[model samples]
Target: MRVGSMIVRPLHHVILAAFSFIMAFPFIWMITSAFKTNDEIWAYPPVLLPDKLLWENISKAWHAAPFDLYVFNSVFVSVCIVLIQTVNSAMMAYALVHMRFPLGRPLLAIILVSYMLPGAATYLPGYIILSNLGLIDTYGGLIISNSVSVFTIFMIYQAFRQIPREVVEAAKIDGAPHRRILWTMVIPLTAPYFVVTGLITFIEMYNNYLWPSLITHNPDLYLVSAGLRSFFIEGGAYGMNWAQVMAASSFTILPLLILFIFAQKFIMKGVSQSYGVNKG
Candidate 1:
């Protein structure tokens, strides 16, 4: 059995490595194509590498649109949404898990059920509310509309459940306020869950296209996804400037890549911990 296991483990790793390369090939192609000339891009045999690196492609792509503003808007909105959701999720999850109250279970159930509903179902009402509040086409609308996230609440709820009730009771007996106990004990113990949820929320908000497009018409308020679309249509000249398009695409996703690279360990740790908690 041990010998067979050893053979299977290496085979499993090999399969995973092959799949990883397959998934990454497009991104690799995009980065390399960014430096290729137009002729090389459509070359008969398909050019994996350019004959000469054209650094100008990067510069031209950067200057081709208001990408800097787009990036800033995306980063700012995503960060704000993440922060707001984290706090709201943590507090709500803590209450649901640790504090007993009337209709608590029903409230949690309702929230979870809402998550099961299609997000598109809520867009019309969400837009109407924002319009009534006169927040349409504003950053406040974007930030406030996404301030609450059921997924984050659920993630944190499960994490909080892993904590022993005895610990919370002990803190209560020691005269620690609920807020104090939550901030000092519960939050620290579940930091990994928060990090994982925050990263997920940031990515979702950053990549959100349909809702943002529907709400925001001003070019200056456009997120990265919208900016990329505009660039593809206008600055890219309908794919005539393939090199610059590739270059723009390559840099646009750099922030997400960097974030995932830095937070990958925490994500893995969080998932493992959650799994262990469930098994326990």
Candidate 2:
């Protein structure tokens, strides 16, 4: 059995290494293509690596579009969404999990059902509601529409529910107010979930293209994804500057990559702890 296990372990490692390479290929290609010339990008034999790193790609791409404005819009929207959604979800989840309220279970069920509905299904109604409120083409419109995420609420609720009831009851017995309990006990115990959820929300909001594209007609309000689309379409004299597009793409993704690198430990810890709680 030991001999068989040793052989299987090597095979497993090999398989995982292969899968990791496959997963990383697209990103690697994007970065490499960013530094390649247009002709080199579409070279006959498909150059996996660039012979000469054209540092000009970055400057040219930045000059080609209003990337600064798009970046600002993306960062602002993503941060707002993360902050608003996290706070709202945490509060709501705490209420549903720890408080005794009428129709709480049914309310949670309704929120879960909202998650089942495709985002595309909500586009028309969401647009109509924003239009009615005269919020179209505004930051308020974007931020308000995305502030309450049912999926975030549901995930945080599960984290809240995982807390041992005895701890909460003890806090109450110690004359702790609900707000105090939430701030001191609940927040500390469940911070991992909050961080993970906020990161996920940030990524979603940053990558959002469809809703932003539809809601905002103003070019100045374009988010990174929408801006990338416009940039691709208007590649100036050299139609579809592949290298420049790839360069812009690299810039869009680099911050997210850095964030993930820093935050992945929390994500892993949170997921593991949640599962461990379930098993216990």
List CA RMSD, all candidates: 1.6, 1.6
Give the deviation of candidate 2 from the true structure as CA RMSD: 1.6
TM-score of each: 0.95, 0.95
User: Tens digits of per-residue lDDT for model 1 on 29-85?
Assistant: 999999999999999989799989999999999998888899899999999999999
What tens digits encode model 2's per-residue C-alpha lDDT throughout 15-96?
A: 9999999999999999999999888989998998888999999999888888989988988999999999988988899899
Residue pairs of candidate 1 with colliding backbone atoms: none
Among all candidates shown, the one with the greatest lDDT: 1
Q: Report lDDT (CA) for all predictions.
A: 0.93, 0.91
Candidate 2 at 133: error in angstroms?
2.0
